[model samples]
Target: MRQSVGATDAPEVRPCPECGTEVTVHPWYVTWCAACDWNVDPGAPDPERGRLAQVRRRLASRHGEQLAQEIEQGAGGGRGGPDRSTVLAFGLALLVHGVTVGLCFAAAVLIIGGWHTGIQPVLGVLLLVAVAVLLPRPGRAPSGPAVLYRADAPGLFGLIDEVGAAVGTTGVHAVVVDASVNAGVRTYGYRGRRVMFLGLGLWEILAPQERVALLGHELGHFANGDVRSSFLMHGALRSLAEWHAVLRTVNHDSIVDWFLNALTFLPRWTVYGLLHLLDGLTMRASQRAEYLADTGSARAGSSGAAVALLDRGLLVDGVEAHLRRESMAAARAGGGAGGREEREAAERELWERLAARIGSVPESEYERLRRVSARRGHSVDDTHPPTHLRRRCLASGDPQPALVVCDGPRAQVVAAELAPARALLARRVIRDHAG
Candidate 1:
């Protein structure tokens, strides 16, 4: 998934509350002063942090308002604010680009008609070049990479179908298997068909019920219309980024370059400023959608399973990172004619080792995981809430025991069917990381 977050090239200036030193605020609610080493809210305070979080918190306190009503109805609030903000930002950006293009073309006509002098002609040419470079182009639909379909792996595809139907969506169009420790769903083609990417490593480790919760969380986004919202927001951000990239046509090289840089600096800075503002404004909706998805996961599987998945995520991330490093080393050391097969085998072995390591994790280790899970700071790139917050949210919901949503026999059969795709992608992962 192409995750979206607000960005700003220029640091926000503020004074430190603890020390009086001048501080710069970065995205994800970070306010820090280099001289005084003052950081804001590193303790993972209750109710979340960041400007958007504060806004959501205040909105939650009220009753009968649109957002408050959404929350009261358990319908997932926060979308309205972001939806309006995205449209406004996108419209303003298009307006700016349209005016720029119109002026440039009008100037070109004047110069071509011999109605403008030397400096005007030069200005017209420059404006035309700027328009050409800065204009946003349509994004291409991503090509299908390594994937599996119903014909390729009926059991795996059937399992996905069963889960999808259980979660209340029709079903995904296809599945892309990969070798990371994460999974996501994205839309492709004009019809907005869904393609889900599943990580072999994550699948190998999660229990059957955990898998359901994970899938429900991902697929539920489609059911809840998050995919549609994200698409537009991502497009707006990309267009702004293109404009900014076009304006930054100078390096600190020559006097002319410096002058050009100075000229376009404000425009580039404006794009950054707008991006940051959009990110802050949209964050609440994005994060709320995640919680709502978790709710769906809990409903589909069990609350215990959903919360356990979040708690186990810390361990999963650590184990996967370590095993990937080992796989990289093995691939590097065993280079030869049969290196490909060797690397694949090595990666499979490492994956098994990871699974075993996770199964045998000491009780003491969980305490450490708890500490790490509790240590929270806003991630500028991540739209999901912190895992601890997710766990708490699920816990507060209807109680249910942890149990497998899929039968033991079926889970095993699905696992067996996915072995080929898993091994193929695992090797690809090892090779990429080794390089």
Candidate 2:
């Protein structure tokens, strides 16, 4: 039977597949016969291999690859990429600064160049008007039903049950929607509460343990009330940043622009400097939250499995690249109205490009690059922490600091009761749908 490395330390005597020499199988080297370096197929039906295969299957099921595919098809077709939302955030910032600089420049011209005319004041007012137009207003608070959209209803239900059991709560409801690799917890409608959105892509690439880890993290957001706080903070920052950018831009080309430009050298440096600083702070906070979620996942289930899944996730191209590409694509499509569809498409493209670039390198080389990227301060206005940092932190396993059961007692009971039924189901599903 397949045995967990964590379950034992005693070396088990087994024949090496290659040399047939009696060799001791150590817990750490579960995937290969240490003496001969013979590869072990984890999915093999032999009892020991079957155990590893089951773990792999569990990881795949939790990750929801099938669901991710379905969502991609529904959201629009092809492997969904990032689109407008990413660009809009940048675009909005640009527009705000452009207007501000222009206004300031005009004011300076009037004061310094002695062009104090009625036209100047009118121009100033117009610049202010433009600033008002460019910045986004605060969004309405989320409320209403807790809906979760997904492609695999049964699988999702099982996951929800697992999460609920882990957290000591009744199961949450979910609904599947069309989108690749995106998920979020939202509060919407008139009575604002909690709802979850599961994207098809999220399930596509993650193993089961990673899926649980992700869910645990999201659920932690809900539990900690961080979601609302993030929304408010982001809205306020965007609004203030827009206002400042407008003021800065309106001053450009005017006498004020010359003074400020002389003082600052480059207007963009001044703006971007502040923006990057704020983005970094926010990213750091988000990273910490991610760690908490990882802790929660470990509490809910297998830590090693969760870590393995997260490592895999790090390999997937991130959402930012997808967003960038999507924006360019939508711009090309001539649907530049800044609607939801356009925004989602833009975000997808941005992430897709990043993923493509990263995927081009060999796996071993890629890991090295990722480590280097993490250490050299490579974060660029990202909301999430670098994946390498996340992996390292989770692997340390010291964050939780208390003796809490990784898997819930009730969950274990439920799994024990359902294992037989699930096994039968798995057999039939595999036989009928073997591809």
Highest-scoring model, TM-score: 1
Worst 10 residues of 1 by lDDT: 1-10
Off by over 4 Å in 2: 1-158, 164-179, 225-231, 248-281, 318-380, 398-435
How good is model 1 by TM-score? Answer: 0.70
Local lDDT at 204 for model 2: 32
Q: Estimate each model's TM-score.
A: 0.70, 0.42
Candidate 1 per-residue C-alpha lDDT over 1-435 given as tens digits, one digit per residue, 9 for 90 to 100: 112112235556777787887765544333544454445225444656699977654553331134323543556532343456546655655565666668677767757865546676777777677666555444345443367777777866776676667656766777887766788888776677778888766766788888888887787777665632555556556656767777777778899998998898888898888767666556556666777777667766688778767766766656566566766766665675666666656667755655665665544345445544545434544566666666666665568653326779888887777777766766666676565
The segments of candidate 1 whose C-alpha lies over 4 angstroms from its true place after superposition are 1-145, 227-229, 332-345, 400-404, 430-435
List model 2 lDDT by residue over 1-435, tens digit each: 212213546667877778886765544333344344454334233322567656744543333333233322343121234234333444544544555566667656654565466676666666556545544344355332222333334545566556645644334444433233566665543444445655434443444455566566556555433421444445435755664564453456789778765665565566666565445334434434455555556555456655655665554444333433444444454344554454443343332333444333334334443444343322333445455655655565443321222245534543444343333332332222121
Number of clashes in model 2? 76
